[model samples]
Target: MRIAVIGGGISGLVAAYRLRQRLGADADIVVLEQGGRVGGVLHTRELAGEPVDLGAEAFVGRRPEVIELMSELGLDDQLVRPAGKRPLIWAQGSAHPLPGRTLMGIPSDAESLRGLVDDATFDQVATEPQRPLHWEPGADIDVQTLVGDRFGSQVVERSVDPLLGGVYAGISASIGICAALPTLATALDNGASSLTEAVRTAMPAPSSAPVFGGLRDGYGALIAALTAASGARFVTTMAATRVARAPGGWVVDPIGAVDAVVIATPAPVTARLLHHVAPVAARAAAGIELSSSALVAMALPRETPLPDNSGILIATGEPLRAKAFTLSSRKWPHLAEREVALVRASFGRLGDDKPLFWTDEDLIAAAVADLSTVTGIPIAPIEVVVQRWPGGLPQYAPGHVERIAALESAIADLDGIAVAGAYLHGVGVPACVASGTAAARRVATACIENTQR
Candidate 1:
């Protein structure tokens, strides 16, 4: 049996590696990547003698896909975790720590509201139990409204919205709550339920669960390891322009024929590739919406004054020059040998949709200005690196899961072809890895069954 996997991003690489392991010399597996390098959105660079995470950073430790996959690949010794610190939300010209014992910014326990909320706002939220009517099914909960109703406007606008903005790059109102945060949504469905109960049930005891860790050098190392271990044929910068059906298999045009194919690129790119193989599927893939985002990393001299902790987030309501900043030096001691600080600024989102067309120079300038405001330093950036992503991240809107369900059904009738990526399942790194592994298994099993027959 022969198989073709399009795109060399993390998802595609994982799928190809698994295929090589399962089929070995009996099957022909090849990977094609349009770009000069792999890793997709995962990009890291060393500038001014410091490591900067230009793309995806930490993976959720709760998810086992990344950890298990790393262990299998013999990367267990490279895992390490930095000291943890509290995250602050900057709003109204001041930085405020988020309230604790809260689920998605909703205070479940009254004590959690301590100094974060005003008396009037607290009294208003206390009236949630007095409402005359109960919520009905399919009643869309505007995230802003839900946060304000349960806690206060301060919490919603200052903390919740800004944090969600960083992830979705879109407003929280239109984003699907269940899709973005299923655990919090499930808890809400169980009744505004107490925060204590939610905490006890929603997350496993901290002592029982393993802590989160990242590659010792960086995430880029993980990608390099996968590429080296995959013992399959790999061709870079060879874009698959067309795909057609041939006798006993499908022919990925501009290339040759293959028993099966896995299209693991982004939605827009994937849609274009599927245009000929399944026109209907192409149309559906094109309908999924995505936003653009840019990351500007600046390395300041050791003389630069910065906070002693993790970093600061310019909340939605803050009058800032940029969205957020992460103090890399404080968070990760190994980032630099000297006392120099690495500050990262995130730009672009709905109502702030300007970064999509920003020039590299402009982005760097904006980032420095925001840094000056947050740290009270007027120093210039010693080194700057700007990374822009066209369709930043996927925003799963209402009934989005259903739309994906229909898309899967449309492709079910097609032979020897399957799709997987962040677009199909969850958008995190671990989820993408899981999707790739699953696709490899499905195709491998089908190939074995056909050979037996």
Candidate 2:
């Protein structure tokens, strides 16, 4: 059998690898990547003579997909955990401990945000449960509107934005309530008396397991392992123009006919490819917008006096060009042993693309200035690496869940075409891995059916 996997990001690579396992050695699996490299946003490089991730630094360890894959690849020794240091939030020109016992910064109780917000805002949050809440059962809305209206704008900006920004490269305003905080939505739907009560009900039970994990050698190791195991022919620096049904299966333009096709590109690219085969999905996919961001990973002298926190997140409207900083040495034990201290500054957001246009020198300067502002320490980096990810993350706008459902349903009727991408579900690495595996399963099953027929 012949198969085509479009896009070479984590999703596509995972799909290719899974296909090889399911379809056996005789099957020809080809990965078509528009970029020259396969990892896509999961790039890693050497800094200060050691590996550092330029794209995604870590994966949610609670999700077993990533860790399971690592074990399967004999990369168990590369697994590493964080130092369990809590991150700080820079708000109102000062650093404050990130509020605990909160669901992504939406405090379960007002007491958690004591010193972070003003008196009036604090009072409002404290009495929030007394106020009657009106929520539609299946309603979908942006996080800012719901949060700002209920908990006050301070809560939305100071608490919600900082946490959401790290995950989506966007503030609460750009993210949807249901998709980003499904548990909270469920609580509301179950007739919680107020937002405060809903937040309390939705809060996950505390666990002792580490929240995140990373590879000792960076994500490059994962990418290399997946590529080697897939044994697929790679067509890089080329795009799949279109996909349509052929005589026995499907044809991915520029790659010829294949037994099955997994459209693993971004939302926009997926929309384009499915235009003719699945118009309903195409429109829904096209509606999903993307956000851009840039990163400045710097190597400073190990003696630099940075904070002991894992990272610092700047509250929305903060007078700073960077949104967050990951103090790598403080967060990861493995990274701390390096010759130089490592820090990563993130720039831009969903609605802001100005940082992507800035030169490397400009980004580095901003990182230095911002770091100095937040940490109250001198900033001097011996080496710097800049990476820009334009349209890297997709915005989970209001009704995102519905849109994805419609897109998936529309494509399900197709004989040998499947879809997998970050835009379809959660944007994290584990979700992408799950998506790729599911797509490969669907395509492999279809190919087997065709052969039987």
Candidate 3:
């Protein structure tokens, strides 16, 4: 039973691993990775003689997928949580405490955003419940449009944009509420009279468990474990050029005939592969857009005197080049033990990807200058690493939910092949893991039925 898993990202790797567990020793699972290595955007590297994640640093621990997978892989010992510190919002040329108990930066009450916004905006948010709201049930629109109309531009720009940018690598103006903030959307659908009420109703109940988790060594550990456990033949630097219907099953180009295929690539690449087999699905995927981003990880002196906060998020309209700063040493307890302080400066977004083209030296300089401006500290880096992620994140634009639904429906009847990636339900590591597991189940089930026949 030969199977092919294309892409080699978290989604693809998880699919291959799941397939191995389901199909056992007899199945031949091949992972085709176009890059020199696996882990697509989940790459980790050494910095100052210690492993640090160059791509995604953490996963939402509240989500069961990552934690459960860690336990299954005997990697629970490597799990580490954050220090429960909150990030600050850099706006209006000052740093303000990020509004608490808010739903993705949308304030549940005016008090949360009191000092963050100006007097006028604060007053508007305070009286927001008094203002009548008209929301169409089952409607979808950008977060900025919905929040801006009710809470004013400051709430969307200063409060919401930064948080959304951190998640989507895009601004609130491009992110849809239905997918980005499902709980709030359901609240609005259930007849919430105001945006404030929706946010309040949608806020997650307080829990003692940490919100995020990460591997002690880095994501590279997780990737290495998944690759080994999958027991799949790794085909590095090989891109699956085509996937077409073959007698009894399918033929994956260069990989030959296989009982099944998991196309877990980026949206554009997935669209291209599905074009011949699932044209409608291809069009839907092709319509989905991607956002680029860059990161500058700097290791400064251990006594750099950085703020006590977790990180600083930049608001829209801010003059700063960096979108956010993750104080690695402050945020993660495990990293605090390092001899030097670690900070990661994020750059680029959906509309602005100029930083991706900037040289590593330029990116490092911007990160240094911005860190100095935000922290009021003299900038000096003992070591630096710059990583560029072009087309890294898929924008969950307005109508995204509907588009994905249609795409999935169009491919429902395609036998022995399935699609999965960040472009699906979410862009987070947990979401990708879920998508891959589901894809493997679908493919494995189909392969079994064929064998029975």
Candidate 4:
């Protein structure tokens, strides 16, 4: 059997690796990467002789899939934790620690939230009458509406919006409350009813495990290892312009043919690839939106006094050039040898373009100004690099789940074809791997069914 995996991003790589694991040496596996190198979003850059991650910085801990994969690749020991895992919120002209008792900005601890807001606001939040309503436990709902109803518009706009911008690079209004955060939605459905109560109930159990971890060398190591194991022919600078079905399976024109295919590229690219194979699916994919973002990574002199926490996320309305800056030196000590500071200034999101978007020089100036306000440290970056990702972050708009389900249904009817990436599932490294793994399993099952037939 022949299998061709499209897009050598993490998803494509995982799918190919799983095929090798499940189908053994009998099946021929090929990975077609449009880029010159693998590790789509897992890029690592060097600054002042120290490795800096420009793409995904860390994966969530306790996520068994990422941890298991790390162990499999013998990259577990390289895992390092941030100095203080808690991220500070930059709001109200200052950087404030994320209030305790909150689960992703939802009040898990009402008392903790009191300190975050004024006394009057706190009273209103705490005494806010729970409107008479009934939502089933674990029932899906819109997150933005849920937050505004349970908490207040203030909480959502001031905290939630900026936080989402920091991590998802999107507007909270766009992200499906249930799909992006299922547990909280379930809690809201339960008698916990209100946002504060639901947050307290849904708060993650305490664990000794670290909250975040990154490779000693970098995430690039995992990408390289996965690429090597896939044993697929890599083609860089060759963007897959189209995809179509061929006899017995599928044929990737100008590339080759295979019994199966897995697309692991971004939403736009994936949509373009599916246009010829399945117009409906392509259209559905094209409609799924994404946000633009830029990460300005700078290496500051060790003498700089960075923020206390791992990083700080500015509030939605806060006047700043960038959204937040994660102190890499504080987060992962090993990454910086000297007193140098490794800072990542994230800028831009949907409906907000204050990143001073233009040349890297302009972007850098804006990021520096934002950093000055948040960190109170005025220092020039010795080495700075700007990575602009246009429409990189997928927006899980309202009714996203339904659209995705419809798209999946359409794709299921097609033989020897599969779509897997962050766009369909959670937009993180773990989710991508899970999606790829599932696709690989599906392919293996198809191969078995073909043999029986």
CA error at residue 202 for candidate 1, angstroms:
4.6
Model 4 regions more than 4 Å off: 133-141, 336-339, 353-356, 451-453
Candidate 3 has which clashing residue pairs, if any? none
| Candidate 2 weakest lDDT stretch, 10 residues | 171-180
Stronger candidate by TM-score (1 vs 4): 4
lDDT tens string, model 4, 1-453? 888788788898999999888888888887777677777778887877777788888888667778788788777787776665677876678666777666667665446665456676666577654555466664555567777776677677666786777667886787776777777766666676556666767778888777776788788888878877766667766776667777778777557777877787888888888887788888888888878888899989887887657778777777677777888877777855655788888888877655536788888888888888777879699889888776767888766776788778888978778889988978888888899999999887887788779
In candidate 4 the C-alpha lDDT for residue 207 amounts to 80
Consecutive 10-residue window with the lowest summed lDDT within model 1: 192-201
Q: Which structure is stronger by lDDT: 1 or 3?
A: 3
Candidate 1 local Cα displacement, residue 210, angstroms: 6.0
TM-score: model 3 vs. ground truth:
0.99
Residue range with the least summed lDDT across 10 consecutive positions in model 4 = 129-138
Tens digits of per-residue lDDT, candidate 3, 47-121, equal 999999988999999999998998999999999999989999999999999998898899888888988898999
* Stretches > 4 Å off in candidate 2: none
Candidate 2's TM-score: 0.99
Tell me the RMSD of model 3 versus the true structure. 0.8
Candidate 1 segments exceeding 4 Å error: 109-119, 138-142, 148-153, 190-211, 276-280, 336-339
lDDT of 2 by residue, 213-259 (tens): 99999999999999999999999999999898888888898979898
lDDT of 3 at 197: 87
Q: By lDDT, rank the candidates, best first.
A: 2, 3, 4, 1
